[model samples]
Target chain A: MFVIKCPYCGERDQTEFSCHGESHIARPENPNEVNDKEWGEYLFFRSNPKGIHYERWTHDHGCRQWFNVKRHTVTDKIIQTYTMGESKPEDNNV
Target chain B: MKYSLLNLVRNSFSYHENWQEAWSSPELKKEYDIIIVGGGGHGLGTAYYLAKEFGLKNIAVLEKGWIGGGNTGRNTTIIRSNYLWDESAALYNHAVNLWEGLSSELNYNVMFSQRGLFHLAHTVHDMQEITRRGYSNHLNGIDAEILDKEQVLKKIPYINGDGRYPIMGALLQRRGGTARHDAVAWGYARAAENLGVDIIQNCEVKGINITNGTVTGLETTRGSVKAKKVGLVPAGHSSVLANMAGFHLPINSVPLQALVSEPIKPILDCVIMSNAVHVYVSQSDKGEIVVGAGSDAYNSYSQRGSFDMIEHIMGPLVELFPIFSRLKMLRQWGGIVDVTPDRSPIIGKTPVENLFINCGWGTGGFKATPGSAHTFAETVATGEPSKMAAPFSIDRHYSGALVDEAAAAAVAH
Candidate 1:
């Protein structure tokens, strides 16, 4: 079992948080502005990187807040856990 | 050497000293007609069928590690075709048909057993869902029967019928069962080797070389090998390979964990799955109780899951089978499963020409081994999706036409 250092609540068991899938995927600015292909890509496509990955997590039991986690998929190493609106870290070394 | 009773006796005469290697370890060739990446069961099976059925010689299967060391060996080894959709029924049933003859066809005993699969229902909704799936399976000409609690109890006497979630009814598929997962990989490897297919171990595909939207070759850890066609059968790492090809698959990789109890006297003969409980149990021929759990909450290429996930699954497992409460877990491990949004596989050509992909089986790929290989071999050979594989093309995602199997898959896979 791994521990996720929640941005709101410092270092919590992974069970206290629920993965919200790939992060930084913003909704379409205008619903009808894009074609079906673009809309689908925005809705479904994901990087799913085997190395470093950026994903969202919700601390369901701890602080009950959402945040972004830059993690290494292969290593299960959490490089950084930042607030949801923050940008990806420049040096995502994990 | 063909595994026959006569050969067994002939080998016994010399203390079994003349036994030949099941498959040969060959040096990677500079060029092959077709190259299959990820030397798991599906890759090995694809190579076998490609050479035997498609008549393509000078083929090689590249594996990063030894064969069957991936999900092929990590799965619970349950095989079933009782699906809710016609496409899935057709595809998986095709595998069942091929599985019926896999042993003889590969000249090796895969130890396929036809013990029925019982999907237990703990609630009325589960019963309704099972009934719907049963009818859908029957409409697709797949074997399925709805069994009440009495039948379920009769089939499995050790289960707690009156647990917290009382057993209601089940969907029974008599053709569904389990097989020796490793033997399957070995059998296919041997048969493919005999058919002039090179089985290259420790050769990982680092990059896919495509020239002008068509296939050229692969850059491997060993060296670059040229090929006109490349079929990717990588399970959880499909997206990683797709990235190397300059494409993105709508696939997420997660760790699906499984555990086995210490060997004991044979008690459970049939496979039992409970979607409500999120656990499936089956006894191996060697008398170990194999239990499968759902995927971990997060995406992970690391084949380790959170310990609480195991703790959560074991609660329901023991609640159903109280006798196993004291049984010690011999080993626990996980396999990375590449799950798609529709819970269906993508088989056929990709955006890059001549780069065929047969992946996204998710947690239920073992049962589809033969059918996957059979159709993939055809697709790669003819540069078209086979009749059975047409519905699973990647274009369906864009067209918004999917053979959704979410309800059928549930948590069992």
Candidate 2:
């Protein structure tokens, strides 16, 4: 277990936060036009990479806000954290 | 050398020094009819069956590490077939049937102890869920029996019946039990190698060579190897491999941790699993209590879990079995499990031609090793999923025909 710098609540234990996997998947604007495969891809397919993953986390116990975390999947190290509306960081050196 | 009494007696004359190696580390071949990625039990078993049953020739199994060094050796080794769905029941029960004769067929002592497995219920909802699953298992010709509190206590008197989250009842699958996890891998490897299937270790697949959306070969750490029909069985890194082939699997690789307590006199004779309490424990033949905990909240490939997970299970473990309160944990390790949305495995052809994928067993792939390899060999050989594996094809995610076994998974995700 590690500490998470929650964008809204500052630093907190990882237990206080909940990870909602793979952030920034936009829903189709015209859902009625998308085919079954496209809809399924949106619903199920994930880019579960071995390294350099951008994901969502919610501070369930502390500030109760959602944010994005750019972490290394293999090392479990958090490189950066930003609020939900903010764009992904350009420099992902880790 | 076939392992037998005569062989044992013959080896004893040489002070057990002249016994041959179980399997050979052959040089990588340039091409083969089939190439199985990953040297775990599932992959090795797939190669074995492809050669033995399907009469396939020139098959190879590539391993990034030593054989059975991945999740195959890391699982808790709890084997059971009492599933809630008909599809899973059929699939898992096929493994159970093969497991019954695996030791004899492979000429190896896998030590499969069918000491019974009990799924305890602590709450009303758990009771209902297990009752439904037990009936479903019976209807599917698999064995299951629901026992009330008295019957549960009568069988396992050591369990605390009046503790916090008291045990109300349990669903017992007498045929379910543990096996020697490493032996299962070694046995399959040796048997597969004896059938002329090449077992190559320290061979990592660096890239998938796909031409015109069909798998042609793989570039490996050792060298490039050609195989038109390739079966991908890399368990936790499945999505990584899929990405190499211009596709993605609906999989999330997460760490699942298990620990064993210091060896003591045998107290727990059977496996006791409580999904409600989130603790499963079984005593090894060497007398250490093997305990399993739930997965961590976040995804990880670190092969280690949070300390809170230990505290989480220890609290309920002591509540259920006060005897284990003082036993020190000997060692703890984690395995990266490839979890799916519906908690069922994906065993079928991939989008890339001649590329078969057998993965997404999530937290319980070890139990389905033999059955998965058996059916997957057919899928790889004929480019079509066997009847037993058809329901678990990749198309299920699109058609929404999921086998949904999250409840019966025995671990609360």
The DockQ of each candidate is 0.76, 0.82
Clashing pairs in 1: none
TM-score of 2: 0.98
lDDT for each residue of candidate 2 in B229-347, tens digit (9 for 90 to 100): 99999988999999989899998888898999999997988989988878888999999999887887677888888877888778888989998899999999989999998999999
Please provide, for model 2 over A1-94, each residue's C-alpha lDDT reduced to its tens digit, 9 standing for 90 to 100.
7899997778888889889999989888999999989988899988888988899999999888989999998999999999998988864488
Q: Per-residue error at B79 for model 1, in Å?
A: 0.5
Q: Candidate 2 local accuracy as lDDT?
A: 0.91
> After superposition, which runs of candidate 1 have C-alpha atoms over 4 Å from their true positions?
none
lDDT of model 1, residue B312: 77
**Number of colliding residue pairs in each model:** 0, 0
Name model 2 segments beyond 4 Å from true.
B407-413
Give me the displacement of residue B24 in model 2, in angstroms: 1.0
Scored against the true structure, residue B93 in model 2 reaches a CA lDDT of 98
Interface RMSD of each: 1.1, 0.9
